[model samples]
Target: MLLQSPWPSRVNDSSTKATHVFITDFLKEKGVSTLDVLVNNAAIGSECFKETFDVNVVGTVAVTWANVNRVLR
Candidate 1:
């Protein structure tokens, strides 16, 4: 199934735990126990500054933190 899908698949909400769980399962399914690198590049320049900051700053931090602990040494 994954082989049929396109590369560079995206996870919409990085801050969501469900997304993290999905990622954990997906990686496991692919026989990956840990991540090698995590790139937090979720940036946006929306009209609402707070919203932009939440997604770009908080969300990125949240995602990176969640994945860092799981990455391979």
Candidate 2:
């Protein structure tokens, strides 16, 4: 089993970029140079549609772009 420890952060907040950077650094520290897969699974539920869009859509884009280089082609 590929167990990954969760690092939870508010993806809709201003700290999103910083969070991604920190995650990248943390992975580097673990001797991980490239990511074979990335599962953007966090999503703000339907109770708030705009928040859902912000977190699920924009947040996914932000995090993905931030780690683009670290992903395996």
Candidate 3:
């Protein structure tokens, strides 16, 4: 089954440690032991480089790290 959960609307919000924990916890609560794939498509086009980088890079890394263990090889 493909389970899709709502992510934080703001990239900055989604990048936080708390958000990471919430994602994993949500999955666990839903009985998801493993994931076949992960798609980090959260990004934004902004005049502020920091904002863009935070969402595109830091956010991706944070989310990936949070769920890496649950992903299937």
Candidate 4:
């Protein structure tokens, strides 16, 4: 099944623990037991280094870790 869930686009919002929980809950609510692949493509090319790091680096790690158990090995 192809589940297309909405992720937070904003830098601050994307990396939060709440966002990760929400995403996981969303998948569970939709009956997604396991995911074949997770395409974490959230990024930002802003002048602010913190914003860029938050979205590109922190956000990616947070989301991946949050859903790691759901991914098919």
The list of candidate 4 runs beyond 4 A from truth reads 1-47
Per-residue alpha-carbon lDDT of model 2 for 1-73, expressed as tens digits? 1125453443443587876776677577778877787545465344566777688889999999999989856
Q: Which candidate ranks first by lDDT, i.e. highest? A: 1
Cα lDDT of all candidates, in order? 0.70, 0.66, 0.64, 0.64
Cα lDDT tens digits, model 3, 15-42, are 7887676666757877877666754545
Task: List, residue by residue over 1-73, the lDDT tens digit for candidate 1.
Answer: 4345754445667469877876797788889888887654455233565776688889999998889967746
In candidate 1, which residue pairs get closer than 3 Å at backbone N, Cα or C atoms, i.e. clash?
Answer: none
Tell me the TM-score of each prediction against the true structure.
0.38, 0.33, 0.34, 0.33
| Sequence-dependent TM-score of model 1 | 0.38
Predicted candidate 4 versus true structure: per-residue lDDT over 1-73, tens digit per residue: 2245353333335568876766677578778776676544455334565677688889999999999989856
What local lDDT score does residue 33 receive in model 2, on the 0 to 100 scale? 79
Report the Cα lDDT for candidate 1.
0.70
Top candidate (TM-score): 1
Error of 1 at 55 (Å): 24
